[model samples]
Target chain A: MSAALLSAEALRIGYRGTSMLPELSFAVAPGTVISIVGHNGSGKSTLLKTILGLTPKLGGEIRIRRDARLGYVPQRETMDPIYPVTVGELVETGRYGIRGVGRRLTPPDRARVREMLEATGTARLERRLFRTLSGGEQQRALLARALCAEPSVLVLDEPTASMDEKGAHEAMGLTLALARKHGAAIVMVNHFIDLVAEVSDQVIHLDRDHQRVTIGPPAEVLKGRGSQGRYSS
Target chain B: MSEKLALFAASWELWRGAVAAGVVAGAVCGFVGIYVVLHRIVFVSAAMSQVSSLGVMLAFWLVQAQAIETAHHSEDILPLLFAALFTGVFSAAMAGHASARLSDRTKSSEAFIGSVYLLSSAALVLVGDQVTRGAHDVANILFGNTVIVDLPHLLLFAGVSLPIAVLHVWLRKDLLFVSFDPVMATTLGYPVTWLRVLLLVSLGMVISIGTRTIGALPVFSFSVLPPIAALALFENLRSSFWASAVIGALSAFLGYVTSFLLGLPTGASMAATAGVFLLVAKGLQRLRD
Candidate 1:
């Protein structure tokens, strides 16, 4: 197997020194989609945060490729709309890491931002205030911001939370296309079991009652697991 | 008005110090205030200003107790140092508290800030009573005597303000990213905690030294109102930053001129002028909408 883009061994994730999920291990590879599914408070988001080093890991070894760059599309609700930034300006910030500090966005950076905006279908909304965009639009803009960084690992938490069925499907299609084109690894926390089973190559299901995690191909794990208990619709 | 202008122009050397001080204070406050308003930590700034004032009063009391000659320019160092120290400690504490993940049962952070403000205000009064010889000196500490701004004070303000302004400009995007979306900033490998601490510390240092030169009220006003006005006027953050700095500088110059012509308190006039700019910006935004 090609080297895993990201790997976790006996990972324990939580906040304030308390582990919410059972010990888990997984590896993600380029051009592969790994969907994390669980009930509320089942450490789905915590796991993503832990992997991204946003939260503390009680005991775990998370190893990313030395040169892997990360792009994150955080939960839409977590971002405050009170911030005064235009869609273009907000998306332009993704270039900061690549461009380094104290330097203005070069032509290439602006070109990338424009390309991402176009890819995300937010080209028309570039000049609009970020706060004025609807939830679905904001989600798309945020995805554009993340993609503009040209990250090797793209992690998203509920990318379709505010999107409708059609919007969500379209967004996922675009994401899949982008991943294939860029050869990036995608790790997402998703609640929709059907969608997870459809789009993800691998699925990690967290059974809160049993305090256990089941990881395997979507066909093997999600089969006959129709909408019951924590996986219930 | 003409006669006042002639007098003001004739004694340009006399008032130049105050003008320089006002412009520097305005620019620094304008730059820092964007973060303050965007981060929605206005109360933290207020608390910081109050703590800084208390630091100044404590320094004055210590100087009086030691019977040190206040006339010497070197004496100003003691108060500035104390203010910076006190403000730094308070800013660190506030930053830590704000970053903490507390239980729902704990008192909100605003309550803690309020308590700090109340305690600092009362302490300032108590310290002023013991240290200051009369009400005039207390007024000078609270509101600042713009006329007393000499070349040394102007140089000090410039020395502090320039570097901070440069840092803000150079790190504008990183700072904005950290302030607006810390989670994403961290995910991108930016040190969110350190950036936040740096921002708070810089704010404290600015308020500390600026308050010593321009009084707490004007510093607080300049740090808040101009950013708000700029936000009302501009759609983009970068434009808002530049516009805020310009508005702050203009407000200060116009306010000083108003103070000279109308025989009003300089700090209060500057604050009022900033308020006017905010109102005008709001009106313009409304009309555009």
Candidate 2:
């Protein structure tokens, strides 16, 4: 692999000083997808937020490439529907990262937004209010927004949490294909263990109740958990 | 009605400055208040109004204490300078408020806004008792007097608000992005802190300058009510802002005219007019629904 897009060493995740998950380390490179799966309150979110700089790290060192352009797709619920934003407008906001604030999007930026919207199968829904979209469509539009910036690293929180089973599979497949196409490193928290196991290059399973951190390719990391892993998902 | 119109037109020279001040106050606060409404910080604007009132009262207290001697010494800008400094601190506070979850906000963020409103309101009342030698009466000091607003004061009000309105419009996208999603905005390296500072500074200017002409009550009402009416009426953000500005200006104009015709107090008249707009907006929204 080329240089890693993001790496963490002996990193612990928690609030203040209390550690919820034990020390774990992993590195992700461009064009690769890393999926994190854990039960609710298992520190999956804390760890993701820790790496993404939303929350502070409890211990250890994490480094993202200095020049990397970061993109984020929070769960649809994370966005306030009261904002009165259209899908196209929401997608266009992705360009704000690349162009910097106070600068309007240019023609090339608009083209990229359209391309991403089309790629995510959200072109037809561009004019619709983002809040009015179905769960699956909202996720796809948010995906388009995340990709619109051509980010070097993308972080997602429960991108398909609101979708149906089939939609979940499609969303993950689209995510993998899109990340590969854009050569972006993907870090996502997903509830679908099978989906994560199917598409991810690396998997991080955080069992906070056990104070355990398991990191490896899906087969190697997931093979031993059997019923517990299945039950958790 | 024609007779009233004729009478009002005849008195336009005396009321023109106050009317112009009302329109500027309405438009600027209406624009800034959209964020205040959307961010669920109506109380922040209310509290900032009290903070600005206290600052102005402090200016009056300074005059009474012989801190600065001039013609109309209460017009001194020590309050504005003080307000600007306090608002910069609130920029950080609001940034913290923006980043916290809604569940955590009541304890962590809103409590601060509540504290400021209470403390500032109390201090302003205590200080209002000491200004024995100014042209401003205690009633006019707290509620403000657009009816008596002079040319220089109107110019000053416009001077402060217009530039802030232009900046808000110019950075509309960036400001919206930061307001809607501080996490992603910060991740993307947008200047979240500076944007918050700009927003707070704008709110401060609206409250401080506005209280000088229109008083705290109408300033708060203008900042909140027209935006409420606008948000209820428009589904588009830009439309909401435009409607808000227009409604605010109209309300101010109508309120000024109504005060003259009905012999009502100017501040109360403007606030009541905004209340009437809010009711009409609610009715239209229900009908549309």
Give the range of the ten consecutive residues with the poorest summed lDDT in model 1 chain B.
Answer: B98-107
In model 2, where do residues sit more than 4 Å from their true spots? A227-233, B67-75, B83-88, B96-107, B133-136
Quote model 2's TM-score: 0.94
Provide interface RMSD per model, one decimal: 2.9, 2.6
> For candidate 2, lDDT tens digit of each residue in A77-143?
8888878888999999888978987788999999999999999999999989899998888989988
Q: TM-score of chain A for candidate 1?
A: 0.93
Worst 10 residues of 2 chain A by lDDT: A224-233
TM-score of chain B of 2: 0.91
**Model 1 over residues A161-222: C-alpha lDDT tens digits?**
75656777887888888877877889998766677888899999887678889999998778
Pairs of residues at least 3 apart in sequence or in different chains that clash in candidate 1: none
Clashes of each: 0, 0
